[model samples]
Target: MNSEAAIRAAQNQWKHRGAQRPAFALPTQPGQESVWDYPRPPALLSDTRTVQVRAKGNTAPIANSVRALRVLETAAPPTWYIPKQDIDMQRLVELKGQSSFCEWKGAATYWAISNASAQPVAWSYEKPRSEFAALQGHICFYPSRVECYVNDERVRPQPSEFYGGWVTDEVIGPFKGDPGTSHW
Candidate 1:
């Protein structure tokens, strides 16, 4: 089957699985961000700051840049997409044979960072939909697979496997990826 077909099959399986979402901590402090405040259908915002991603097991930064964009959606944290020019191209090797579909962004290509222990740490949309054209050639890292930092502050991975939001002190939850939030 084609990649899209495979993805659909997997999603269907996940829907059919007999599992309930679990309860999680909803700790929030003043001045932090709340996912409830984000917009629906998501909004693409310009984030001008130093963004960096390091291998999960390494201290050295594998990708870093000041030019990046952020996507904010209701019930989810922000996901940053760094420009190709500012990223360290040498460390990220492209992966093949898999793709993901986002209603707004279009298809995505995966990238693996090369460190002493590197895997597919990020993904990019070579040709984003015209509405999201700014994201073209910009890569987004998976926080669970790699450590992401914004302006030197390390980020927390979003709670779910499908959502790749880099949660920082500024953003609040209960965010997506947490137990029982899949339907959110």
Candidate 2:
């Protein structure tokens, strides 16, 4: 089977089985959160909070949207996806690179903004799977590359380059992509 097929089968298997839930969710207290509460196979939710991504050294945001979507997955921090309409498309240049496939979201392409701001600092799924249809034509930025903010709180990039989860002060984790978290 192809990678996509394998991923779907795994997703279906995990979806039905009651497992992968973190034992410790760090008590979802006021001003604090844990990644354990997030779901496996991930789920998308509409975010009313303002999301902004400022190009490096730029005072103004190159991308900003109030109607963004957040992908919540178990063991990972939330990834904020901004709508295409919210970004300055003129400053974006889609580069050719090997794309990635998400079990839930289908295929995603790499992206970089123009003006020599950054290279491959973001990605987008132009036509996502039905489960994430809302994300079509939307791009999710890497907090590590650009200054990303959600509702006035600056975000920290998820530990590594692969998973694009945004880490805020509220979300606490020995999050995925960190050293020795490969088993997770």
Best by TM-score: 2
lDDT of 2 by residue, 34-56 (tens): 77767776779998998999987
- Tens-digit per-residue lDDT, 59-177, candidate 1: 77777787789988766788999888877788878887867777556788988765434456788889876778888978999998888999999898887677788889898767767
As for model 2, its CA RMSD to the true structure in angstroms is: 2.7
Candidate 1's clash total is 4
Off by over 4 Å in 1: 1-30, 57-59, 115-119
In candidate 1, the residue pairs with backbone N, CA or C atoms under 3 Å apart (3 or more residues apart, or in different chains) clash, namely: 33-170, 33-172, 159-177, 160-177
Per-model lDDT = 0.75, 0.81
- List candidate 2 segments past 4 Å from native: 1-4, 10-25
